[model samples]
Target: MSLPLTRLLRKLLHVAAKPMRHAQGKDGYVIHAYRGYGSHSEAFLMGRIFRQPGSRSQLAPGAGRDLMDVGRRMLRWGKSGVEVEVALGDNRTTAITDRDGYFSVHLPLDEPLEHQGQWHTARITACPPKQPPVEGEAQVYLPPISTRLGVISDIDDTVMYTGVANKLKMLYRLFIESAERRTAFPGVAALYQALHEGDDGQQQRPLLYVSRGPWSIYEMLEVFFQHNRIPVGPILFLREWGLTLQRPLPRRSEDHKQALIEKMLGLYDEMQFLLIGDSGQHDPEVYAEVVRRYPGRICAIYIRQIGDSDSRKAELDRLGEELAALGCVMLLSTDSLDMAHHAHANGYIDAASVEMVRAEIEHQLADEPA
Candidate 1:
């Protein structure tokens, strides 16, 4: 089957598989696992348990759940003790699920997970009573020794213009628009691609994308990234919440973003990171605090300026001064071209890639409807 047709068939299967899920409530279910990453001594992985009724054939999206029969169970599913097991090459660990059915495990490897063009497989098993156990696999990522810097990026307005600050528009863009139609900032992909290929333009740097978004949209974001030609890495997202019918509106996570960044910093402690976010949210404050805590760990901070940040120029200036005192430079701009120029000038990318970034921006603008 062709690629598009294959994807369509998978979606159809998911729809067919929904009836079973609708019937199962939250019993033994498929595990929607994501890739994890870490040093040789330690590793991390995460995924959600989805109880959907269906045969194995029905759940076959690239990240689909395992096959399981959804039999009659209690009408209401309450949050309680649920355990899952994970196994790496030479390590295995178990963790319990939270209220929203999200589980994370940190594996301690006796030795380093050496660099190879291979994905470390994580075998995950979920057992809930009466129903058979469902199993799935997730991959882990680790950069090469030649990595020059690490890239930690935000997902919303920084890369794609989701208007997260505006609730209505955020939903419209997120749910209404197709991934192709969703607006990605011009040259952002090019800039990320250039950074992924470090100063030598051939080395693979560790590029981690952190999001305030929930895990429910993981597959959608994967599709968006694939469509936009952005590099795929371990997607670390905030916990899933607000899913209960009683509370339709979920609460946003507190300080998890900075906390996740700090965890990654521990992995690549000695390396410098290019922290990319937008001034539209608390990113400036969060990143500034990061520089203060891990002084010299951040080579530069690029905060995208949304429409008319001029009204808060003094605030931005104060932030710049504080970050400077901690030995971190920051740039507040509206375009990735400026970041490309800075990256090139600061030895983050080859001079030739800077032009690649500029060309991408011009091409993107030219393709846009005026």
Candidate 2:
């Protein structure tokens, strides 16, 4: 299909998915099941089912007002008090969505998934009367047996430059740009790819991306990863954009992130992680805590220094010393090439991959205006 035609079809679907005002309305909701990745002992899958306006509102100026409008629209479309069933690896479970229209199911697997980390299809069907029994498909990834380590990284400034500290520009970058136009930090794609393909150069290490964004933007972020040549993995967003019409949903940030990191640690108990994030947010603090809690479970913590702030430097320095005491190296650098070199030295990636990352950084630098 032509690009215009594809977009037109999506617009039509969005229109058709609008909520009916009546409580017993028959119009169906939309389900967005994110692609999930996990290990042999268990599999994690998550998604959202909304009343389905899908928030097609225009990106007007002013951050606070626009964000409030988006939130209201999502709340308007959330289909609360509904049950969703998930099936994978012959095990099944049912979960009822909260007022926010989000559902998650983590299933245990006694048998091993395929050794090649092949994609497995999982079925998610919304309960009766949310009908015609609307079903959504999700992809579950099982990492290869050659996996040496698992990587958990933050998305905003570490890989893609979303300017999370600047709310308006962040909103503009998210809502207005096409996926291909969204930029990944220079050299990040190459570095992530190297980490994905570990030191032996052929092993496919488990790579996961974690973000604090809402589930509504999951599809757009997947597209961004595709266009930017970043290896996509299970994207675990922190909050549900949907909410009940009668009450307000409190904003959640730091604590929720820490809990999710602990969950990941529990799931992959045998695999150590290489932590990646930027100084613009609470990554230094959150990761320092992870290093303290997990002890030797973290191989290294690489923080991308966002700006020249004495306070930021001091915090990272304090955390770096703390992490070092726990026997994990903490690196604070302004460039992905520095992380690449660290990974290479630590055997996370091979020496040749280090040169590849350096070359990519040089190429990207030359493309920028002097």
Candidate 3:
């Protein structure tokens, strides 16, 4: 009788392991623990299984599976919450959370919404059924990008040359690759300081720094800027999806950047923006596409001539003219300060304010620590 009773109890425990139902939250869906009566049926939320917004969703070898794992735990946070991610399918999208745990994502509506020609919903699974079944759908919409005058700048060679491409060789010098190491173009720091940090009595404007570099470098970058007295602003970063446990989302690098710019444009509709990049790779091409797609939103394009290769410079010059035709200023300068002043005087910023900002930056540059 004792042995029979023990076996029966084991069977009961296995049956209770099943989840009662999934819970729905504000951001996305979540997994929940199964419910049991006269006992603790609280869902420990072991894990989750769902399709990402892609051709294969959770089909990829390492990429999609990791997303599924954390996505489940992300939702299983408290009792009811959403697990958010960039809108699937396209490569460039990223997900972000508002201060209140509310989240939203931006996607290129122009891209194909279907996979293999089949339309699909931005699918997400909910866990631990809510008492009233909360909706986990992301119905929040972002405004368009044509209304703001903003600038998105790069950090590596364009802002500071930390030799990002040769990561293997520069592993030892990572500490030195900071905003302090970020030698400002003669006037660049002043330009950004004035616009973002604000002048004597003027209200500061918003400046967003978007870099392809990892977030790990952000602290050093921040320290460099603060040490140099550069004005601070919202700093966006890619989630730890690739290097860490999180899998690479669709369009991990370039696409993610494009999406971020698009979202920024939508949020600040009336103002145009300035874009700063380098001639090293695809900034010209990328900025060109941005101009073509959202012509009125970009105010200027600044590319640093880090490489002395004539063929590359010529190609960049041609692209600059094309950008100029769209009312965009394309600058290739060795001086950071010159690029900043040029950006300011080209009507991107007020001249007087630029001068003031420039003076302040000069003071910082001169007062280097002993």
- Best TM-score goes to which candidate? 1
Candidate 1 lDDT over 1-370, as tens digits, reads 7775555545534433443454333444657678888765678898767554333344443325412322222222333346888888757899988776778888887754434653577788887666677777888876765565899998878888873445456544544444434557888888999998878867678888877776555655665577677888655565555567776766543376788789888887767889999887888889998888887788999999887456577798898998887788899999898999999889899888889889888887787666
Model 1: lDDT to the true structure: 0.72
Q: Name the weakest run of 10 consecutive residues (lDDT summed) in model 3.
A: 36-45
For residue 47, model 2's alpha carbon misses the true position, in angstroms, by: 1.3
Q: Is 1 or 3 the stronger prediction by TM-score?
A: 1
**Which scores better on lDDT, 1 or 3?**
1
Per TM-score, what order, best first? Answer: 1, 2, 3
- For candidate 3, write residues 1-370 as lDDT tens digits: 5764444444333222212112221233332211110001010011222222212243443433444433543333333144433333342243333222333333444454333311123432333224332223221112122213456776666655544466532332333323343354445566676554333323334566766665434444554456555555444433333332344443455666678778766656666777777777677788888998997788777788776698888888888888888877777876666665775566455666667656755765676555
- Cα error, residue 41 of model 2, in Å, equals 2.1
Query: Which candidate's lDDT is highest?
Result: 1
- Candidate 3 accuracy as TM-score: 0.53
TM-score, each model?
Answer: 0.80, 0.79, 0.53
Off by over 4 Å in 1: 1-28, 55-80, 111-115, 163-182, 240-254
